[model samples]
Each structure stands twice: as structure tokens, then as C-alpha cells.
Target: MAKYKGRILFVLAGALLIIIWDFIYYFVLQYSFNLQVDLLFGTLILFIGYYTGKNYDESNETVSAISKSEEKIKRLNEELHLVLQNITEVVFHTNSKGEFQFLNHSWEELTGYSIKESIHKNALHFISLHERHEFLRVLRRSISEQKEKTKIDFSFQTRSGQFRWGEVNIKLNYDENGELAGTVGTISDITERIHNEEELLEMNETLAIESQKLSVAGQLAAGIAHEVRNPLTSINGFLQLLRDDADEKTREYLEIVFSEIKRIELVLSELLILAKPQSVTYKRINIVETLDHVAKLLNTNAILYNIEIQTAFKQRDLYIRGDENQLKQVFINLVKNAIEAMPHGGNIMIEAGLNEYNKVELSFKDEGIGMKKQILDKLGEPFFTTKTKGTGLGLTICLRILRDHSADISVQSEQGEGTTFSIKFEAAHQQERKKREQTQKVW
Candidate 1:
């Protein structure tokens, strides 16, 4: 048996003495206790009472500490909730199973869906289909490697079915015991930022195109002056000679002068069309008539190269709204290009019809040495040409005219196989022009 400690002994001795005093007073001592005995019992009882009170005080102290800790935790939780509610970007957490555990107020505001509707949903539900694979790959890699943080860009669909670009920063979560808990991520809407970046890129490209045009214009200016001066000088010298002396040679000289004047007039007209900005004059144009006129005009040029121009019209009366002269210019440039492509001489096929889209489809297919990818890519850039003596502005001017008419053009070429230039215009009978204007936000 173990020996009792001082406090235990005091308690036990006090209890035992009380029992003995009770027995002696009731049976042996017959109703009376001495004063000395009573004093001693009273002191023992006071010591035992003091020991009991001390134990209770120690228990109360421990309870008070625990209550204070609980109050601090409650305050911290309230502060976190307030912060999540007011933040502008999405804050979210998910379980290991990829189900959403919590979505902050920002999620509701950005996606236009209430928290009650999104709770416990799969996190992938908001990801766009095309971006889901990438999102999953990044997420799995982060979780598997226990990455502290990772970033990804993806498209997120809103409650109203609009997909917007988003960039998310993800962090893997763990419990206090270092076990896998889930993931927490923050998402920011990047749609407008991406759009602005694209706009800047397009603006830069346009600036580059304009700079090339200016350089080409400067070169053309000198060439035009030289080319025009020669023809004019020839006509002037011939007329002066005719005035000084009239003879049998005068008739031949007169013919030469007239031909020189015609050539100069043609050069000046082409230069004026390109250099001067003219207001668009809209009229209903017959596609067949325009094609015929262009073929007749380029017939002599084609015959010189031994290349034949073949025309086929599935619909004779196809109509579109555009400037007739500009349309004629477009075809002339295209046919001339076709003729130039085939140095060995080949057939140039021109076709016009209503395509499946109910738009007028006009195509120029050439059986010539096709263009390589590098040259084809820079087709519309000013001064970028593949020909040995080409001005390179023919295709650029065609593209500009097509855009002004709300038309579309495409080129398909394979090196050594041949090339095709396809142009599509809205049909006059259909309401396509109106629809195009509305979609393009044309004033």
C-alpha cells in the first residue's frame, strides 16, 4: 500500500476523527464533548474545506482560458466572411473530388448565378468545352506535384451562356495534419484585356500597311512622271515636225502621234483612279455585263500572251450593288494577273453564279505557275509582289474596293498546282446587304 501525501492524510484524518467523535458522543460519552476535543475537530474541518476550494479555483481558470480562445476564433471567421463578400474577383475552394466547397460573393456577381445554385456543383461546369482539357491538365499536375501555386488562362461560361476569358491562380490546399484537403483558386475576368490586345495588334498591322503604301506611292510618283513625259515629248516633237514640213511622211507621223496620245491618256486615267479618293456611287450592277466588258477590254492583252479567256455563267442576271467602273477595274486587274502568271500560255477560266450561301460567287482560276506560301501570305501588302516587273498594287487596290462594297475575297494556291481567286458579293434581291450592315455596325 502506498503512503498518503500531506493533504490526503489531513483529509482522511479529519474524516476519521469526526466519525469517532460522533460515536463517542452518542454511545460512549453520553451527549457531551469536551472543549479541547471540539477545537481540534474544528481546525481539521477548516483545512479540508480549504483544499476543496483550491481544486475548484484551478478548474475555473482552465475554463476561462478556453472561452477566450473560442471568442477569438469566432471573430476571425466573421472577418474572413466579410472580406470574401466584398472582394471584386472570384474566390473559390473545392474538395479533393473537384466539387465546389465555397464560392465567394464575387463569383455570384460575375457569373450572375447565386451561391445557392452553384454550391456543390462540379468546378468544371463553368469551364468552356474547348478549355476543359487544358484546365484539367493543369489542375491535375498541380495537385499531383503538390505545387504551391500555378496560373492558367481559360474561357469561363456565365450563367446567361456567354463565354468570357479568365485567368486563374490556383493553390493546392492541405489540412493541419498535412493530408490533401482540396484546392483554392482566384479568377479574374480577362475578356476586355484580351480584346484590347488584339485591337492593338490589328492597329499595328494597319500602320505597317499604310507605311508600305506611302513608300510605294513615292516610287510610283517618279515612275509616273518619267513614263508620262516620254509619251508627251514624242507627241510634241512629231506635231512640231509636221508644222514645219508637210509631206508623204506626215500621215504616218500623225498616226504615231495619235497612238502616243492614247497611251498617255490610259496611263493618266489609271493613276488618277488609284491616287485620287473618289466617293462611292452605288448602282445595281449586272454581273454578266461587267464580265463581258472586262473580257473585251483585256482580249488584246490576252491574245498577245497566247492565253485564252474562258467565261461561264450559271446565272446570267446575277446582280449586286457597286460602282460599275470600279467593278470593271477589279476584273481587269485579276485577268491581267492571270495572263501574267502563265508565261507559257494557258486558259483563264472566269465563272459567276449564286453560291450555296445565296451570295454571288465570282472566281478567276489560272493554269499558271502557282505562288508559294510566303508570297501568297503577303498578297495584299503594298509593294510586295512576286513578278519581275510587277507594281504590286493591283491586288491591294482590289482588296480595298472589295471591302468598300461589303464583299469578301479568298485566294487558294498551291505551288506548281495553280491558283484561284474567289470573290463573294451579297445578292441584290436578298436582304443580305442590310444584314451585313447591321452586323458590321456600319453607320
Candidate 2:
């Protein structure tokens, strides 16, 4: 409305000026005024005024629109920055030379390096030395192939000197002339995922190997028991009959023969167990009590060997789902092994507690002659042992029993430093909760 009024006033002013000029030309100059010229000048002045006002209004509108557009752009930029700052993955930009040009807050969180300090640093600097070459090779290959985007997984060094897995996704950028400008990308922390995949793969391989071994052992055990048991039984019966009528020296020889036969019987029994494990009745059993019982049962044996058996529990009522007798047998075997490892006298530390994952963790640590890597790797194999008279089936049987109870075992040892066997089991409460969830799902 104001603009219209201004345009009207401009026209009126222009007409008034033109009329005053006409009067001055007619009266002051004493000349005849031409009506046609006056009318032409008035019309031209009106047209000029209207044209100027129309352009002024359009100019104002253009400026207002520009201001609004600038404000919107600024707001969008701020939102983009906020998203980049809070995301868990590191978003970054680099120059053609692979020098970092920009990095979001997540880079600092992942690498422990300040954004200010990390700028202009080479991307390869953070990668592990062994993996840097491969990283660069893949990046160059993608560029050479004229690929717009690429992904690579590599191990990168963190600020604390630890290497972690990172999956990098890169998008290439170019200048107006289509020449390479730089690259924008994201780095995701995939360390946990990678470790989990590796563990799963290792477990699958181990299960396959174990299955094959069990199959062979089963066939062997069946054949050996069928062919050897009857003859051994007949020979033992005749030997006992002959021993009752023999002299003192002959009786002593007969007793040794009886002991050898008994040892053979024990081996056969263990083989059978390995071939076909007995059916187990799993129940919620207190792990603390089981460990305590095993410790007490072996306490006298440890004492005679100049060894001390110690027990520690973080919680008194820690429980797990397992067969009680089988679990006790497993613990006994581990404790006995610990006692045997230390010939000169040492401490056998048995500890039970809840781990970070809320699983029941039980460990047997012994201060003794620890094994070399090659020997440790062979553990759990049938007929593998370090002891002079060991049949090597003890640990194999213990491993099978623990597997039946759904336990995970790990061994850590260093020559001259001693060994620790750690076992983890799902807590009884957790097991019950999982069952309930499955039941709910079924319903």
C-alpha cells in the first residue's frame, strides 16, 4: 500500500513540475505555449514514474527472498554439523594426498586423538604397519578403476597402542574439471564384530575336529572291547585260581599281574565313556559347594605331595545348570592335574566368581612347571599326556563332560610361569530366563 501511494505521489509531483515549467515558458518568456508539446511531456513523465516504482518493488522482493534463503541454508548447515558430531562412526574428509582435511567428534572418541591435532595427518598413520600397505593398495585400485565408492576393512592402531578393526567406506570427490579433489568417508569400529566372527569360526572348526575324533574313537572302542574284554576276563579268572595255590613269591608275581589287568580295565572304561557319554540329568547346582567338595576330597592328596589346595569364591550361592556328579568329576580331574603339575610343592588356587558377562567363572591356577606352546596345543586330544604313566584320557573325558554342561574353557600358560584353566558357564538364573523367553515365544 505504501509503495502504491509513493508511486501516486511521484506521478502528481511530475505533473505539477511539468505544468509549472509550461507556465514559466508561456508567461515569463512571453512565448506561445504548444498544447501538443505540454501533453506529450506530461504523458512521458507519468510513464517514467510508473516504470521506476515497479522496478523498486521487484528489487525489494528479490532482496527479501535472498535473505530468507541464506537463513535457511545456515540452519541446515548447523543441523548437519550436529548429526556429524554425535554419530558413533567417524565421518571424515581427506585431500587427494590422503591427508585428513576434516574429522568429526567420533574420530577423537575412537582414536583418542584431538580433532585439532589429527587434522592434516596422513590416514595411513593410524593403520597397523602390516595392514597399511594393503589399505593403500586397495584405495589406489579403486581410484584407478574409476570407482565412485569403495570399502575396506583393516586393523588400525589406537592412542593406547592397541590395534582394533575398522571398516572404512570411502566416496571419491572431484573438482569441476573432473580431476581428483579428495575423498569423504566413514570409519566404523568393527573390532567386537570381527572378534566374534573369528571366535565362531574357530569354534566350528574345533567342533568338526572333535566330531571326527569321537567317531574314530567310538569305532575303535567298540572293536577293542569286543575282542579284548572276554579274553582278559578268562585270563584273570584263571590267574586268581592259580594264585590261591601258589607259593609266596608266585603270589607276589600274581598280585602285580592283577594290578596291570586292573589298569587295562580302567583305560577301557574311559574309552567307552569317550565313545558314548552317559545321559546327564541337569539341575541348578551350587557351583561354590561343588568346588569346595572337590577341594576337600583332594586336600589330603595335595598335602602328601607337599602342595596346598586353596579355595576362594566371590559369592557363596553362585549356581549353574549342570549334572552334579559330572561337574564334580571335572573339578576333581582339574585339581588333580594341578597337584601333579607341581612336583616340588606349590599352591593350587581354585577360584569361583561371576564374570563381567554375568556368567559363572571358575579357574584353577597352579604354580608349577608350565607347558610349552606345542604341548599346550595338543591338550584334549585322546592319548596325549606329559606324565610318564598317564593314559591322557583324563583331560579328554573332563573336556567332554564340561561340553555336555555347556561350559567354555580356556587355558593360559607360559613356560616357567605356571598355568591357569578358566571355565565359564551360564548362570542358573540366566539359563532359566532364557528358557522362559523361549517358552513365551512358543506361546
Candidate 3:
């Protein structure tokens, strides 16, 4: 329109110049010119100018409208970019061939793969190898069924060689003609939540075992206590009498009888501990002193086995609210077990420290024979022992005592690598700390 308008204005100016020249020639030089022809020429130039000027104004209005529309689109894209960047869940788009076309900010944060590196990469690259086949199967099923949306849970590998569980929700992207374009999806890292759920399930299983102990305690205690104690007492008394007047051979026999009797007594005592629900006497005791005392008491046994007992008390003045005797017994059993594990003399480390969770942790690690997964799983059960002379009641008692103190215990072992028995107790002042925090919040 501008070009047309410029051409018309030029024509109008030329026509005016020519008409003026024609008048000049006719008046000054007696040159005759056609006046009607000049009028026709001027009129035609005015009409073209008027029409072209109107068209030029319309063209300007059209350009202004298009500029406004482009500005709106620009703003929309900016807003969408902000939303995608700020969202925690990873958002992405992939072609039908499963190659990534777009990935949001969270994708980089979670997978440590920048947007530039991720583009044109296969979407399955983020998924673990074992799960990639399953992912492809799910995608195929969705496509074959013509489903608009599909959801799948799979483990995704990160740039650091760590795997995290991600839940993906995918939808088929289509054009205005309803033909398939590609897939768009969101991925949420559920690794922490998955771990928490698994921990809760394991805790529930442990709690169920504890419940069974309580239930069996009542029923078995009543029958066993009365039936076994009387006869065992009589046998112990008779054996003592016989051992006093016996010769060398007979004395040895009597001594064996006495030892067997004592073993029965020890078993009975452990049963009673489990059978009766006794109130735990809680006291704020220094955990360091308790561990030191237990280690000292077991020092002789450790020395006899040619093992060195090492203490690593990383924190001082650590305290917990628990039954002093029971807690001491727990340490004694754990340390003694560690000593016995090393028949050929190895190091026994008893370490104590405060964990990030504000819990006091004591670990008894033995450089002796370790246990397999099967034995580790059945550790706290009654009558479950790996040692030939082990009563198995020792660990059971330890577990019961720790449970009474509201503590947690975990054991890790690998065959021939050694074992670590970790017991965690809430710090004595932890509750006070929590109360102070809550009060501060209230204030």
C-alpha cells in the first residue's frame, strides 16, 4: 500500500507540473495546449491518490492489530516458562520415537542432566535398564489401546549413578486434526517416600512380632513356671549334695549335672524376663559410664579369646532415660557376643556417638565371622542362635530390654566380613529440646 500511495502522489505532482508548464507556454510563447486534456489528467491523478491513501490507512491498522497479537503471545510464553521452571515435578515432551524434545527445570535438578544435553536423547535413557523394557511395554499398550493417558512407576537413573523411583503420568499429544504428535509427561521423584513406606512396613512386621511375644508370654508363663521350677530346684539341691562327697570321676559327673542344672536355670530366667511384663525403671544415666562399665566387665572374656576390645566414645556426657540394669545387660550381651564371635582373636569395637536424628547410637562391631541375610533376619527370635553353646535367649533379652526403653536396634553383617550391631536410643534431653522448640513456635 505504501508503494502504491507513493506512485500515485508522484503521478499527481507530475501532472500538476505539466499543466503549469502548458499554461506558461500558451501564455508566454503563444504555444497552444489542450485544456480539456489537462483537466482529465488532473482528475484521474486525484481519484487514484484518494483510493491509495485509504488503502494505506487500512494497512497500518492491520499491522497494529498483528503487533498486539504477537505481544500477547510473547507474554503467554513467558508466563508458561515461569510456571514450568518453578514447578517441582519434572515436565517433558517426547516424540513418538521416545526422543526428548523438551524438559523442564526440575528435570535438570533431579537427573543432573541439563536441558541441552537432554534434548534429542532417548527418554528411556533416564530409566533403569531392567525397567526400560517394562516402560516400553506400557507405552505400546497405551498406544495400541489408543489410550489418551497412562501412568507407570519405574526407577530412573541419575547422572551420579544413583537410581530413584519416579512416578510418571503421560498423555498422548495430538494436533488439531486429532492425529498423534508425541507424548507429554510429568515425573515425580518418589524415592524418599518409597523408602519411608518400606520402612513403615518393616516396622509393622517388627511390631507384630512384639505383639506375639506379649500374647505368648501370658499363656506360656503360667504353665511353664509352675511345672519346671519345682523339679529343677530339687535336681539342683540333689546335685549339690552328691558333689560334696564324690571322688574325682563322680565329682566330674556331679559337676556336669550341676552345670546342666545351671543352664536350665539360665533359660528359665530369660523366659521369665520375656514372660512377665515388668515396669521399666527409667533413670537419666550417663551412657558413657554405662558402656565403659560393661566393656570393663567383659574385658576378661575378650582377653581370654585373644581379642582386643576397643572403645570409641565420640561424644561425652551422653545420657538416655532407660532402666540402668537392663541397659547395662544389653551392652554386656552385645559385647560378650562380639567377643565370642572371634574365636581366633579379632578386634571388638564399641563405639558411641550422637546421630543427626538427636539419638544416641552405640555400635558393637566384631571382626569375627559374620552372618548371612537369613540369620540376620531371624536374629531376635526365641531359640534362634548360630553358636553351638549359644542360648539364643541373650539377643532376645537384649531386644526386649531395648524395646522397653523405646530404643531401636539394627544389625548389619556380611559373611566373613564382620558384623555390626547398632542400638539407637533417644537422648535423655531430646524431649525437653522438642518441648522448647514447640514453646518457641507458640510464642
Candidate 4:
């Protein structure tokens, strides 16, 4: 409508000018009407109207194109803002001086720092002190190499003053002259991933050490069982025969000898368990029932030692796939250790429940004298024990049994603060289905 109005106004003004000119020529100039002059004047007016209208249409098209482009740019900016606000990772932009220029909503969510307050602050300030040097080195190296993109994993400090693992991917921005202008990057929370990786690496190291111990045990097991046990058994029989005829003083010595022989036999048996693989019956067994039986069996022993044993379970029907006897041994060892730790008679709390992963978790927490870090680290090693009479193989055998049942064991202890042993196993249903799938695949 507006474009047409401009054309209409031009045509009207041209027609009015032609009328005035013709009137002047006929009335004021006192000249007779000339057909050629009127025709030429009318033709000139039409030509001017056509030329002005064409120019107005072209100008209007250019204005419309500019308006559409601006609208497109506005829509795009809105979409970008929405994405940055909703993403889980922190999106950021920094100037060449490493000062923050822009931060998205996730930055506040992750670091507990408001975006408005964080802007213009040095980004390196949020990185852990120990990692800052490495971060700067990486940034400088990227710029020196003229790399457009780079990545680094660092510990990022939050507003609460705790550090979390973050993996940052950076894309360098440059001016037209190729000088560094700033950087755009995203930081993702990798705390869980880093923890899992550390656990896996520690587990691998532990397995390597256990493998070496097992090799040594295997070499010693067969020799000791066959070459030494037979003679010891014969000598034990003789000692018992002689014990009946010995004097009181001699009897005391014989008793000590008998106890030592029994200790040796116990050690030999545990070595066999650790060094050799036994037939395991994998079936769904109620873990609650197993734990209850262990508790009952040890109740008398615990009472004699001036200790009390308590049992608690989140559910009544907790089940797992494992050999009942082997599982019982593991629980018994852990409970007994707890009982022994508290010589002055403290309570041992045995609890079972489902963990976050939906796996069965059984924990034994004891109010007893705890171990130091060095002793705790050496817990599962062969011949490692804190007790005077311990064969040092009991806990190792328990660990081996649990490992065969696909269970994980962890211990926490602080000097004078007591200790807790936690064991995790796959739920019975999950384990059963996993085995069935494996069997089917094998067939």
C-alpha cells in the first residue's frame, strides 16, 4: 500500500503539472492549442511516472530483504540462548587474557557461582591450584601450535570450595589478522567417570599382586600338603598316645605341641582353598538366611569373648547367586574379625540392604580398635595378620571365596574409631539371567 501511494502521488503531481502548463500555453501565452505540444507534454508526464514507480519498487524490495534478515538473526539468537540455558555442560567464552566473557546457566548449576558475578573473573581462578600450571601450559601450547581446537581434563573448584573432575573442550577464536582473540569451550562433569577409572586401575594393581601371591601359594601348597602333612599327622598321633602316659609337667608341653600342630593344619587347609579352585554350586540362595545362620553360629563364641552380635536387614527375602557354604564362611570370617577387634566387648552390627545400583550390600560395622592405613592396605595379602595366633590366611581365603562368587569387598577403618566391612553382590535374579544368557550363547 505504501509503495503504491508513492507511485500514485508521483503520477498525480505530474498530471497537475501538465494541466497548468497547457492552461498557461492556451490562456496566458495567448497561443492557439498545438496538437504536437500537447501530445509531447502528455508523453513526458507518463515517462516520468513510469521511471519513478520502478525505482520505488526496487527500493521497497531492498527494505523488505533487510527486515527479513534481521528477523532471522533474532530467532537464531533466541534458539542459541535456549540451548545454552538447558544443556548439562557448562558453556563459556573467555578473552585472550583468560577473563570470562560469557557463561551459561549450567555454570551456576555446576559451580554454584552466579553468571553475572562470574563474568570478567579470571577463568583460571576456578581451576584447582595444582592443575592451574598444567592448564596454562596446555593453553599456551595450543596457541603456539596454532591449533583451532584442544581439550584438557582438570579439577574444577566450585563455589562451595570443593573440586570436581571436568573435561574441557576448547575452540580458539582469532581476529581477522590471525592473532588470538579468545576461546569458547564446554566443561563436562567427569567426577564419576574419574572415580570409576581410578577404582579400575587400583583393582588391576590389586589383581596383579594377588596373582603373584597365588603363584607362590600354588608352588608351596602341593609340596606342604603331601610332603609335610603326612609326617605331621603321624607325629600327632604318637604325641597323643604319649600324652596319656606323661607327667603333669610333660602334659603341659604336649598340649602346646598339639595346639601348634592344629594351627599348622589350619594354615595348610586355607592355602589349599586359596591356591586351588573348588567346585562351586551357583544357585539362588536367600542371603538373609545365610547371614542369620552365621550370626547364630557365632553367637556363643561372641558371648564368651564378651561381645554382642546384632543383625539387621532392610528386606526379609534378599537373595543372591552363590554357594551357601562359601558365602557363610565369608560372613563368619568378617563377623569374627569384628568380634576380635573389640577386646573390651563392643557391639557388632551386621546390616544388609539394597545399594544404589540395586545390588545386595552387606556391611559389618564393629565398635572395636581399628587398624592403621598400612595394616588395612595389607589386609588381603597372604600371611598378613594382626593377631598373635592368626594363620594370616583366613581373610585371604574369605576374599578368594567372595571373588569366586562375583562379589566386591571394601573396608574402612580409623584408629580408635572402629571399622566397617562392606560386601556387594549382584541381585539373585540379575545374576541368574546373566548366567542363562551366557550359557545360551555358549550353546
Candidate 5:
């Protein structure tokens, strides 16, 4: 009876333990506590899980954005390198005190110095010492004014110890707020460009010489033809004399010879001026008197073109020491050019005034077909003419004469507008002119 009573107690205790286990298994282990037996472990695991998931998403997004940014930067760097690769000219940046700050691949290649060597290098070392003060003054002024573009020519010694002429164009570098930053410019290897231009000029000069030679040849041919024709004329006269007594057929042949001889003389006479250039006798003559004379000579043409010819000769006596014939030629050429330019009637303004330097400035402006810039550049070159029937030597000869007389000429022409030629000579007092002439004689 005691054993049965003990077993019954054991069984009741076991049933109570099972009910407690079942109560803890589903709800406590999953929600309140874990199998680790420490209540703190359950709390720690819950906090860690939520935080790790949030951290992982944020990190992944940040990494992806950073990768894209890196790719963009790499592409830009490649583009910059490619653009600067083939340039042979020096491209650089410098500060106010002539310290080099940035230099491109061209600057490195041209100077044979790396960017590291160029940094903090004085630009004065590159530019000439004599022009340094003047040079910097201009640069600073232009920068301070925030001039967008300014071009200046300077001579500099390169890293190779060679002097080079650089035509540098600088623009004021400004920040976002319009404050001056520094100067940025490109240094072109104008050495080759200049050399080629000089070569081209030399070649053009050679062509001019050849053309002059041809002109001489033409003159020689004309002179020889003239002499031959004169003898032939005499021979034809004798033939005509014979023909007077000869048969009809003989007389006809003689008439042909006589006609040919006369035709030859006309062509020869026109070309004789080129063979024997006329020497000028310069004299100090009053120009007003000659201008009066020119008025009468050009009157016919002025009337023919229905052009209004006007003169403004109010000065007492403007004397010039030049050949009368040559000066007349110059005036004639100018007037003719102006008249031709104005096919339709247009006003021609002629003014004689004393320049600021007191030089005798004679201006002839015509409202006519003006010229292009390209044409003006080679204005005095022989054979460059706007006229279809122009010999093209008129302006060339005029320029030569003006230069010989120690005078200067300036011309302004524009397309479809008008052309103006300003002629200047030393308008020193008559006494001063004599003094200069005497000084020249003594020297």
C-alpha cells in the first residue's frame, strides 16, 4: 500500500513537469526567451538581426553610386588626355608673379621639362628682362580690367636656350563670382608659321623679280621691233616707188608691206616707256599750282563719267620736294582709281590738312566699290588689280615713288562702301625742309 501510494505521487509530479514544458516550448522560446537559457541572448539576437539588414542595404547603395562616379571621372580624364596629346605648342597657366601653376602635355613636350619642374618656375626667365616691367604692366592692367581677350607679342628664351617670338593671347580668368583668378593662354609654335610665311614672301619676291624681268624682255622686244619696222618702212617706201611703175600684182604686194610696217611702229611706241624708265628731277614746288593744272586735265573724264569733281585748296602754299611728273602721275592714278571705283556718279572728297604731327596730309576719299581686307593686304603688289583692263603697275609705281620721297601713305577700303587714300609728307617749315636737305647733302 505504501509502494502504490509513492508511485501515484511520482506520476502526479511528472504530469505537472510536462505541462510546464509545453507552456515554455511554443510561446516562451519563440517570443519571450530562447533555448540558450539566458534571457539576455534572446534580446541581443533580436536587436542584431534588424540592424544588420538595414546596414546591408545602405552599404550596397553607397557602393554602387561610388562605382558610377569613378567611371565618369575616368572617362573625363581620358578625353582631356586625348585632346591635349597632339598639340606641339606650349599651353600653360601662370599667376600674377610669373610663377607657373599648370602646364599641359604640350608645354612639357615643347620645353622638355616635366610639370613638376615647371611648377613655381619664374616666367621672367622665359621673357626678356628689358621688356619685363612693360610686359607685366600690360598683363596686370588687362587682367584687372577683366579683359576677355588681349594679344601681345613678346620674345622669350625657351628651356633649350633659344630665343623665340611668341604671340600670346591671354584672357582674364575669373572665378564664379567674377573675381580675377589667373591668366590662361596657349603658346603656339609660331616659329614654323613665321618661317613659312617668310619663305612664301621670298618666293613672291622672286616671282615679282621674274615678272619685272619679263617686262624688261617685253620692252626689249618692242624696241627691236621698232627699229626693224623703221628700216622696213623705208624699204616699203622704196617698194611703193617701184610699185608706182610696176604691174598691178607687184603694187598690191608693196601695199601690204607698207601697211604692216605702219602697224609695227604703233605697238613699239606704246611699249618704249617700259624699256627706258624716266629719271625724275625733284624740286621744291608749290602743290596748289600743280593741282590747278590737274583739274583741267581730268575735267574731260570727270564730265564723261558724270562725276562731280570738287577741290578744297584754301591753303597758301603747300610745298613738296618731289618730281613734278611723278607727283602728277600719283595724283592721276589716284583720281583714275577713284573714278573707276565709282561707276555710277558718287561724291569724291579731297581734303588737305595738317596732321597732329604737323605733317602735310592729303586725303582722297571716293564713294565707290571698295576693297576686301585680303585685297588690301597685297595692295601694292604688282599685277594685283581689280580692273579687267588694268595694267596693275599704277599703284606699285605710286607706292615706290612715295617711299623714295620719304613719305607715308595709308589706305582704308571696305567692300561695297568706299576707299580712302591718305598721303602724308614732311610738312616742316620751308626753312626746316632746306635744313634737312642741306644736312643730307653734307652727310
Candidate 6:
């Protein structure tokens, strides 16, 4: 009766029992039953049947609830096991003591350990011996600050005792009070990624080496050509003296020898130009004046060949900062090629203007037979030529010079119509020098 839940029902039952028993004993049982002792047997039978039925129902319900709870737990455990088995990389959970408490099947496969072996050892034991010190440093730092998560790249020793790089991500587990409890993490093999990075680094290093080799080859050739100049001058002087002393018949033969030597010297000079590296010597040169001078030199040839040569330039002075000789060479090659292409005295137009970015834009147009796409692609490759008795070095040298100056060039042409060549030089830096009145402007 002291217990509230059971007390109320038990008290009600007792009150009913007393009233019913008295009624049965005094009225029906007392009169009908000749024996007074039959009351105890009737009451005992009713009490036993009622208590037994209630107890049985309550016990059955308790058993059913327990069975359902155990079934749910089993289902969840199986799902977790399947998930752990599917991953390719390793996965594990550990307590603060560094003992493995849980692991995926990958952990066993990667480390060659059965579940029994892994549960006793910490992750530190699985790492490569050489990388242990570094890993220990990272682990200690992570735990000291109570870091909730950590990502680290390190080497791990596999079951076969080979080193493999891994990218590990670990999260700290905490209790309700935010106290550190343990850690759970995933480890991914990054051995291939690391190897690729190293390979790329090696390739870049090789490119630098190739560039240096090309430079050395150029220097050696230039030195050899310079040495030949002295010998070449002596030979030319003797040939001239011999021609002066001889008769016409023998002189003609000497002249031929001299001409051949001169041709050899010219070849030497071309090689020197190719091998000698250019030093950047910038000076302020008027583009209009340079073009005017070049046109005048070629003007005679234009007339001799009955060609129409014309120039259209901007009114204002357009100056640029560049090597005088190299820039002149580029223009001369363009103009000469234009003239050569137009064999039948066609028009050669040279145009110059400034672009929006304050860059100089120059174009050479010629009424000549245009080239095909295949020829255009190989135009700047050394030793490629269509002209008979041509050295084939002119355009190749032009390409190198322009590339060195960081200038731009483009060509447009149509078959049987004409050809046009364009050059664009950035003048923004020149504009800045003009605006700021840089002291180097005079040059």
C-alpha cells in the first residue's frame, strides 16, 4: 500500500474481497452449504486464478520489449561492419591510451593484421621507423592543443615493410564535458601524388640545363669565328697585292680565288651573327627617321627594277627604346623580302602608326605572289628557303631578333593577290617614360 502504483489497486481488491466473502458466507454459503469450512476453499480458488493471470501477462510484455531491443542492436552492428569493409584506405578508432578500439577491414588488409592483433597496438607502431619522429611531433602537438581535427601527410610502413605516403585526417572525440576521450581518423595513400610532384620538379630542372647548353654552343661558335677574322684579313690583303702585280690572264684567275675567299668570309660572318648573343642596348630612336633612311637606301634598287616603292607614316615623331642595329635588321629583312617577292615591279607599301596602347604598328604590303599555309609555318625555321642562291638565314635571324625584343609580328596573304606583314611594339613603357620624364628619355 505504500507504493502508489500498486497500492491503490491492491486496496480496492481487498475491500471487494471482504464484502463478497461476507455476503457469500452469511447468505448463500451459510444457508446452502451445510459445511461452514467450504468458504476457505472458494476464496483460495478465486485469488490464485486472478493473481496468476495478471503476473503471466506482465512477464510476457517485458520479455517482448527486451527481444526487440536486442534485434535493433544487431542490425546496426552489421551495417557498421559492411560500411567499414567497403573503403579502400585504412580506418580506425582509438582510446586515449592509444589502443585500437575499432577498425575497418581495410586496416587489417593494409597492415596484415587480424582484428585481434590490431586492437592491442596503437597507430604509431604501424608507421615506418624512419618517419616515426616526425609523426610523433605532429601527434604530440595535436593532443597538446586538444585539436578537434588534424590533417597530416606522412609515410607509413605497410605489411610488406615498404614505405608508403599517406594523407591522414583525424578528429578528436570528446565527452559531454568537452574533455578529450579518443580519436577517429581515415588514412589515404598519397604515394603516387607525391611521386608525380617530384617528377615535375625534375623536368623543370632539366629545361634550365638545356638552355645553358644552347648558350654555351653559341659562345663557342662566336669565339671560333672571331679567331678566323685575323687570318681572313691577311689572305685578302695578299690576294689584292697579287692581282695588282699580275697580267690580265693570271689576274683573272687570282680574282676568282679572291672572290671565293670573300664568299667564305661572308659565311663566317653569318655564323658569327648566329652564334654571338646580343646584349640589350636600348636607345631612343625615331621610327619615322629610321624607316625614311632604309627606304632611301632601297629607293635606288626600286627604281633600277622599275618597282613602285612608297611610304605612309604618322605626322608626329614616333620613337622607341630598342637596339638600333637589331631593329634596323628586322625592318630591312621585311622590306627586302617584300621587294624580292614582287619580281615584276609591283607595289611595295610601308605603313607606320601608333596603336591604342601607345604601341607602334608597322606594316609592309607587297603586290607579290602569296605563300601557302605550310610554307608560312616553317618561315622562321633556320635553313628553310624558296629563293635560289639565298642563304635562308635572313628570316630566321629576324625571328630570333624579334623574339629577343619581345616584339610581335603577323603576316596576311592571298594567293595571286598580295602579301602584308605587320609588327606591333608595345609603347606603354615609352609612354610612362614620357609622362614621368624618366632621365633615360634622351637616349
Q: Clash pairs of candidate 1? A: none
Estimated TM-score per prediction? 0.46, 0.64, 0.60, 0.69, 0.45, 0.46
Better of 1 and 2 by lDDT: 2
CA-RMSD of model 4: 7.9
Candidate with the larger TM-score of 2 and 3: 2
lDDT of 3 by residue, 1-443 (tens): 55466556656776676667667778878866777976787677666766766676677678878999999999999999999989999999998788999989999999998999999999887789899889989888787777899999999878998889999999997667666679998999999999999999999998897769756764575567779999889878887887888899999888787888888777777777777777777888999999888888888878888988889998879998878888888888888787777878989999999999978999999998899899998887777898886767778878878877889899999888799999898898995687699999999
Give the Å shift of residue 137 in candidate 6: 22
lDDT of 4 by residue, 257-352 (tens): 999999899888877777777788888899998989998999999999888889999998998888998888888888888988998997899999
State which candidate has the highest TM-score: 4
TM-score of 3: 0.60
Instruction: Give per-residue lDDT, candidate 1, residue 346.
Output: 83
Selected candidate, larger TM-score, 2 vs 6? 2
Q: Which ten residues in a row have the lowest lDDT in candidate 4?
A: 1-10
lDDT of 6: 0.77
Q: Against the unseen true structure, what C-alpha lDDT does each candidate score?
A: 0.81, 0.90, 0.84, 0.89, 0.73, 0.77
Number of backbone-clashing residue pairs for each candidate, in the order shown: 0, 0, 0, 0, 0, 1
Better of 3 and 6 by TM-score: 3
List pairs with backbone clashes in candidate 6: 284-443
- The local distance difference test score of model 5 is 0.73
